[model samples]
Target: MDPMYQELKEIEHRPYPLQPSPWLMTQVWRDLLFMHYPVSTDIIKSYIPTELELDIFENKAWISMIPLRITNMRARGIPPVPYMNSYLELNVRTYVVYQGIPGIYFFSLDANHPLVVTGARTVTGLPYKHANMSFEKHEETFHYASQRIHTAKKLNVAYQPGHILFEPQEGSIDHWLLERYCMYSFRGGQILRGDIHHDKWKVNRAEAVISTNTLVPFIPGEFIGKPPLLHYSRRRRFFIYPLKEV
Candidate 1:
């Protein structure tokens, strides 16, 4: 087996089944900032579909806001498309489990590209919205900003990666937040899951300042105070599988 595959096989705390047979697409995520906050399980469960169970840690549910650069995206065995090859994406997500398999459930995804946004919504049955977004790096800090089209929702954050890079320890809250291997979507009264494969995440403690954050309205919260946990990753490649009904 290839060394990369060998390393992936050694990933700690992977609870889902391995990626099966052929993959649907591949992509790379870069300059990712993960900001997570704890919420009541009752609040989260009201938003998720009835078919899935909310996955929690110590009786608390969590939501994450991730702003990242997406690149090198393409179908399996195909070259990356011209304009759609790269874009900026910000996602708001929570955790869930279906039939004992843990996965992610996205509340909303905002992207700069219209085609990518439409394609993702159509194919994956997720709520992907078009946004005016920008990403830039100045000195050691990276800046990300996004505004949803035709809506007042907006997010602005500036962050820098810390010096120490390490993997989340097993059974820790960081591990629970970052190590999910599959994602769930609901459409037409059916549950769907898409598997994603990646090597264990190497993350750095992150420092961030939030200038404005109107994205909290999507969840059932009146306000989100300072995030409790923040982490950053330089880059990671992904092997993505097609969505399958559960």
Candidate 2:
């Protein structure tokens, strides 16, 4: 087999041993900024469902606030929908595992489009909220901002990619945070799992200055003061499967 094909196969099969049988939707995430902070395990545990086991790294739990642009979103075998396809999204999430399958559990997901938010809530049963968001590129830096409609949660930051595009090394903290394939959500006292397929992340060293951040109110005040580990990616295509009751 070709070397590249072998590498791709390994990424697909390893970590999580299964793939979603029939993918339900397709989308592209662009200009993503991943900002992660270490938080106390007890604080994170308190906010998540009891059914999920907190996934810790180096004896610590981490939460990420990711801001990205979504484009080319469409259902299977269909073209992108008009007026509902593209938008900005920011999510506060943590890692969790159920029955040995590791996945992401979101605390909150805010998007600019109401139809997209409603559709996601109805289909995936995840916590999706409406927000006003904007994105602009100036010379080198990307300016991003989001404000939730119902809450005081908001974020404003400026970031840009450094000069290199590198992949995370295996068995590293960056690898642990970026290389997850599945996600778990709670709905009506039940747990639902969804698997996402995408190419290996091509990450760039990122620099960000956060002007304002109140995205995760549940996190303790002290932990919020520490600077986050930052990384950026220009784009990635995603294949998202329907949520299956676990």
TM-score for each model:
0.93, 0.92
Ten-residue stretch with the least lDDT total in model 2: 1-10
**What are the per-residue Cα lDDT tens digits for candidate 2 across 23-58?**
777788999999888888987799999999999999
lDDT tens digits by residue: candidate 1, 105-182? 999999999999999999999999999999999999999999999999899999998999998988899888999899
- The root-mean-square deviation over C-alpha atoms between each candidate and the true structure, in angstroms, is 2.5, 3.5
| lDDT values, one for every candidate | 0.87, 0.86
List of clashing residue pairs for candidate 2: none
Error of 1 at 142 (Å): 0.7
Off by over 4 Å in 1: 1-13, 218-225
Best by TM-score: 1
